[model samples]
Target: MKVSFLIDNALREAVVNSCIGILLKAMDIECKLDNYNFFYSPSGFDFFDRTRENIDLTLFPSYNVNRTPEQLSRAIRTNSMMVATHAEQIINSALYKEKLNTSAKSKYSKQITSHFVWGPFFAELLMTHSSIPADKIYITGNPKLQVSTRLNTSTPNLSPSKSVLIVSDFSLGDMDDERWSQFKKRYKANYNTPIHRHYYEARRKLVNWVLTASERYPNIHFKMRIHPGEDRAAYELLKGTNNISLVGDRDFIEDVLDSGLVFSYSSTSLFEVLVMDKQVFNLDLHDLPEERKGEYFELFEWVNKSQFMDILRNYDEGKVFYPSSGRKKLLEKYMYGGNQKAVLRNAIAIKDVLENRIAQYGFSDFLVHYRNLCLSLVKDKAVKAGIWFNKELGLQNYISTLANRRKEADLNNPVRLNPNKIESAYKIASGIVTESEIEILKNNLYEIRKEKDGIYIDF
Candidate 1:
């Protein structure tokens, strides 16, 4: 049987798919993995070329859910299966609530053949709220967590540089006028809150706070890692300062592992740092209304400038900054479950679906498929025209060049895993994949290699 996994985003999806691919190949299963630019790809790419390939199953990360599932269902043969994995372990509280409410009224479960989740928390969340059947919701854990844990243990021990790392998320300042206007419209419609404005105000306040804190502690070097796809020029002010530095084109996990202290305004990295037992502080500088505050923030220690300064001073004096017992418990319960065999479990679940061990859900009704077909036809034409126009104007080449540059930046910040630990994890998970195959898979997963048609996974 042949299985294909789609690579939507390089940094996030590649590692999980690589592990799955190796495991499948080791089990005498054929697997194909490739990258696709979600925005530029034709709407019916999944359907148009389905007949050319003999794929029995396709595994996709969460981003593919934006479009109707008919795109896959109508394209593939009736017997083929489609599986989805949650992109992140923790679903944002607001989005979670929205899903729960909508699931109560709609049968959105028909959207996919099978759904793989992080743990009991997510599985339970879906079972109780979503229309997806409990049996179909397999708790495979998160394969990415396994990689993160392995990387954390394998990382080299370096002398403490007494550096504090600040991680940034997207803000209004990061967007151009046109993009900001579109974002404002979408944010207002979906959230019913002024997220764009609030984010701008909060980010500005937070940046000011960091500058002030940096001035107070001149000895401790402060580094800000701007979020990917953000405009680095927005942070040009930090360039002139000696103590403050903007560290771009670096892996976030590597930064988290290396830093003496990590700070963010409720980023997912907080959970990652906590899992590694690192000192992480949350800067609650985003001045959102009480109702708009996400529940995820409660997991971190919120500190203002004065409290942050105190923590830095204590850390500089060789004092250990311990989180509250409550925060530690929260981290243990939600994020880190001490399981490093997620990849193996994920592979086994895929195998089960492929072998008919797990019951599969059916596709959407004919009316829905017809609607999708009509919408896809229009979209496909628009995309073709856009591509033709871009090529005529040399915009296609320029865009491709920019993408290659970004891919190169990602390749430089490679994740080095402990070879011995990787074998151990594979053995523990009963993975039959050979060590050499796993190594080759890891090397090619994060880098983009060009093909005659487009960029493809070398592995």
Candidate 2:
């Protein structure tokens, strides 16, 4: 039997699907897993042309099967059982609503035979929110959590460093279409400001706080890890600080393990830090009212700039501020369920599906596996060669030097402001602010236009 796991994102989803592919193979099931970017294309029909007849099942990660008409028709023609497993633990209320609403409206939910979730909390959430049948929801804990637990156990001696790690979210950057729409609707009602401007405003405050803390305590290091979708150029202002550094592409687990304290606005990494027994602080500096503070603040130890600064001072003096004792209970309730052998359980469930003992699903080609293996080997070797070349020529440092030079040149150039240019730039920068605010910003910029070489506007 052949099974294909379709993936989009590589960082976390690819890792989880690869582990599931191994588990399926151990259970004598032929599984082909790889990143498929077809979902991002306009014509979703392209995915059907890439597969063969013997493939019996196709699994997706937290995606509705009938997103497009072509997708629904392809599923019907292939007669393949489709399943979806969430890639991350759901924490954001907007995301939860989006997923459940999409799942409820999906016409191919029956063909998408099962929905594997992280824990009982997610299962209950789905059942309570969506129209998907209760039996189809499976509590197969997240594979990433299982891997993280194992890595943490084996690397227990990895001591923490005296550095503060900032786990950034994609909110500070250009958001996708769906997320943009949700943000507009959600924040417009609460704060009466544009969603992107709100994110930018909050991020500016947090960055300033970090800079102030770095200046106050030159002995401690501060590292800002940019999110995958974030444009590093957006944070060019923070460059060249004495005690601050921007993290480059590196393994997140290793970075987290070595961090003394973790800070985030609202990232899923907060859960991972809790599991690792590390100090975590949420930078909750939004201007929303109390009722609109969101659900994450209820669970995490979110603090304002003053509180965070105090905590930093204490940490610099070799004192740590541990989270309240109820954090572990909250962790168990929301993220993990104390199951370390989730991969084994997932494997057994897939085995039952293949054998027709559980919900009927349906793979059988030896050459397909051989061809995939050969391609993967070639890709792996090519990656290794590129790494070796970069190290031998010190290409990374050279690239960094070039980037810094360009940034310096841009910083030295004074930005001339006009009414039309200001309006255009503000629209591009603060996607979705009111007309009144735009006028206010223009007037403010006019006042400060001649005072400095480069104008810096902070809302």
Question: Of the candidates shown, which would achieve the greatest lDDT relative to the real structure?
Answer: 1
Error of 1 at 391 (Å): 7.4
Candidates in order have lDDT scores of 0.60, 0.57
lDDT of 1 at 381: 66
TM-score of 1: 0.73
Expressed as tens digits, the lDDT of each residue in 29-144 for candidate 2 is: 78765444331111112344454364566666655432333333333345566666766545445444445544444443444577677666777666666656655665656656
Clashes of each: 0, 3
Q: How does residue 180 of candidate 2 score in lDDT?
A: 64
How far does residue 215 in candidate 1 sit from its true spot (Å)?
A: 3.4
Location of the lowest summed lDDT over 10 successive residues in candidate 2: 448-457
| Candidates in order: C-alpha RMSD to true structure | 9.5, 19.7
Best by TM-score: 1
lDDT string, candidate 1, 280-347, tens digits: 88886766665545556668678887788788888777776555667767764553244355666666
Candidate 2: residue 160 lDDT (0-100): 51
